[model samples]
Target: MQILPELGAAVASRRKHLGLKQGEVAAMSGVSQEVLSRFERGKVAEFGSRKLLAILGVLGMEIQFVPFIPAGSLDDLRLERGGGS
Candidate 1:
């Protein structure tokens, strides 16, 4: 799942790339213009999946899931270094 900020930025960038305005997307997606604006700005605390899908549909974008790659910890900080003490 994408973070809200990233999603919002992507939507904004896509919309701009398509030469669409917030109001135009809002009308086409059936989402309020203010809500669309807030979402584009990543100012909304909560956004529903339906709304997100609708907006993305209008923008000709879709969400994708990818494997989460865990970060590696510092070997020196690990408890078991497997080295002669």
Candidate 2:
């Protein structure tokens, strides 16, 4: 699964749902705003897992590993599995 896009989207959505700006999340996660912005937009080539975990921690989010078969993109797989945001 192309986890970066899906994970980024979830983080962005959670951050927005919490009424937070990128800078706030970046500061809380100890990541630069530029990196956070790039990550949110799914433009980042690679991101540190610790940084990602920190962002998720700040957003009160956690990663769940479902049964994934990698049929398509993560979004497609989620849809196929009836996962909701």
Candidate 3:
């Protein structure tokens, strides 16, 4: 459920699949190479949304949010099933 690492992996995989270099992507996305590197490394906790969107744009990708269970929902289900929370 760690979203950042998943996102970073997705970017890195797509970038590689597209045969794109970090420098090229950085320039195209208007982000620094170091920032791109860090993002690809899953160090994106501090990265801004604008920068992330810009990078995704350069990679011909888009971000989407999916609906999911809220906090404690899983625990509630577990307890209902006679399982420990």
* Backbone clash numbers for all candidates listed: 0, 0, 0
Per-residue accuracy of model 3 over 1-85 as CA lDDT, tens digit each: 7877888889999999999999999999999999888888997677788988999999999987789976778878899889985
Q: Write out the backbone clash pairs for model 1.
A: none
TM-score, cand. 1: 0.82
Candidate 2 lDDT over 1-85, as tens digits, reads 5779888888999999999999999999899999999998999889898999999999998888778554587887788889944
Q: Is candidate 2 or candidate 3 better by TM-score?
A: 3
Model 2 Cα displacement at 73 (Å)? Answer: 14
- The C-alpha stretches of model 3 lying farther than 4 A from their native spots are 70-75, 82-85
| Candidate order by decreasing lDDT | 2, 3, 1
Provide the global lDDT of candidate 1 against the true structure: 0.88
Which pairs, if any, clash in model 3?
Answer: none
Could you give candidate 1's per-residue lDDT for residues 26-67 as a string of tens digits? 999999999999988989888999999999999889999888
Q: Give the number of the best model, judged by lDDT.
A: 2
Q: What is the TM-score of each predicted model, taking all chains together?
A: 0.82, 0.77, 0.81
Q: What TM-score does model 3 achieve against the real structure? A: 0.81
Candidate 2 segments whose C-alpha is farther than 4 A from its true place: 70-85
